[model samples]
Target: MPSSGETTTLASGHVAVPLEEEDEKRIFRNFPTFTDGASRLNPGRWLLLKGFKDVADRIYNFKLRESDVVIVTFPKSGTTWSQEVVWSMLHDPDLKGAPRSPLMDRPPYLEMEVDQWPTEVKFFVPPLFQAMCPGGDASRGTVVQMLEVEKEPRVIKTHLPLSLLPRDTLDKAKVVYVARNPKDLVTSFYEFSRTIKRLQFQGSLAEFADHFMRDELRYCPYWEHLREAWQKRNHPNLHFIFFEDLKKDSVREYRKLAGFLGSKLSEEQLARVMEHTSFSSMKGRDEALGKSDQMNSEGSFFRSGQTGSWKQKLSHDLESKIDAWTKENVADFGSDFKYFIS
Candidate 1:
């Protein structure tokens, strides 16, 4: 077996093996874990994947270039949608070519634990790159190794809070942070929890809502996640976007995204991008860009994509709870952010 922190060269490329059991235990002991039902929250403060804390560490230290564009979001807050839009904007301006491959295979999830994700979530991992090292099967590659194989100007995705990402890379890379109203966010997350194997979420909507308010859900303390990014909103390289804003005027938001990336799109090109990235078209085909395990199990991920679908799903009392929680947690943000004030 390879030593810890050692990389083994594969027929395709180099991939790192898992740490020795004792070393892994020592490393993970520093982080906290939470549990509900059979779900064991392995360490990381945000976006808790079952046993992916080590991968999170790898992502935190992953070498980043100035040209890299990173998409950061709390889970379910338009991650896939934003990813598709950015991917197209950067890679396929005309929308004329066939997808080079599934979006996941293209941009790659920075911290996705391919082995930990549900079995149904399949993508074409070509043999050109060895995703993970020896122990992992060829079809299931490690996120880190896959990312290492990518070329520059790469678009990466992550759910980690700003504090947890690589400090050196934070100021160097163009970071796009997207958020949604907590009500819709919570509702969507509740439905999403049901579809993931690791969440082990066996509870009613109200129960899950309670978990949400308490910050017990994965990638949680929604307010804190926003707070960290909000404080850094003015960073020259960081961009803040809202789901409602995107829903209200996708063209304008897409234009802003294009501008941030220093790319120019004509009226015709922008319209084509808007049409291709629309929730309807995205939902109807390619399984919402084929980036989510939840979508693979749930069959469809494009549920109502409206600005305020939470009005129907959340009970009056639960809505009151969310409102109060939002105000209390994000009081300092004032009314600048639409989600808190709306």
Candidate 2:
């Protein structure tokens, strides 16, 4: 609950409030002390990081067009990979029209408010990157603002759960939700939290895993998020993609994605997309675009994009704990769900 003077009214006439610390702890009893430069907000059933409170209402009410396509996923769940594949299929099927601009700008992240950070704490956005934003100045406009002015058939990206998005999101737009095994997702999120300056996470993987299992991380209650989408797995407008499946056979998964998005690419064109969206190619592009250099990251944005990489990272005890967590949570999803965790 937010007390008086603790809420801000956004320009959209939406009153936004971060959840009180007491409420947060009450809900996530095992909340840890690893401050990620943001508080938690339960705008609806989902828990989002602090910045989203400001624009959650705006996003929910924003008009969406039938031609629009949104890539939805939990963080570190191969979101960038899906974005690249979807964007390429829609905007650059021939592959020659692709821009050299960072993918962040191409299929802009709808909830990215990095530009709104206080000047002293803002992560460095290189001049070139800033220049490439929809407006020449990144600080001058929010990503949502950019999306508002974007042309039709827009390719939008977001980590917000389906419930937090526009009321008519599924009705008006095609959504591609990417899911990854919790084991790999948490491991990647741990590495990512350490790399991003904003998170300032100094904890070990085990500590991070504790936060994860306790549902204290941003966009957490991971099983619930997946379950929501999984239940709607038959929605006419929604498509599900698994990171492991993508890793197992990118060409096959990509072809399926292309078909779902109604893009009919020739085999040659499909091959071009496969090559461009490959992990190595994407890593090289990110490096060339300086994404890896930002936030004082010790590792590149694209680490080993391999299935089962978690075996190398998680200790036996942690693995057992995650396995039990997965088993308990996914039991309701039916045995078919085993394919994702397997």
lDDT measured at residue 294 in model 1 versus the true structure, 0 to 100: 46
Clashing residue pairs in candidate 2 are none
Question: Which 10 successive residues of model 1 have the least lDDT summed?
Answer: 30-39
TM-score of each: 0.77, 0.83
Clashes of 1: 3
lDDT of 1 by residue, 1-342 (tens): 312333322221223244445533432332222221111222323434334433445555677888889999988899888988887888787987944656555677765653234334323244434532445453333665666656666788888777666656667899999998888888887776665544435667887777677565556668888988898888989999999999998778989989998768888888888899898887787754443654445634567777788988988998888788877887788668776644
**C-alpha positional error of residue 197 in candidate 2 after TM-score superposition, expressed in Å:** 1.9
Task: Rate residue 61 of model 2 by lDDT.
Answer: 77
lDDT measured at residue 232 in model 1 versus the true structure, 0 to 100: 84
Candidate 2 lDDT, tens digit per residue, 109-178? 7666632233354433443444444345554435555666665568998887787778898899999999
**Model 2: worst 10 consecutive residues (lDDT sum):** 28-37
RMSD to truth, every model? 8.2, 4.4
List runs of model 1 lying over 4 Å from the truth. Answer: 1-50, 114-141, 197-200, 287-299
> Which candidate ranks first by lDDT, i.e. highest?
2
- Candidate 2 residue 281 Cα shift, in angstroms, is 1.2
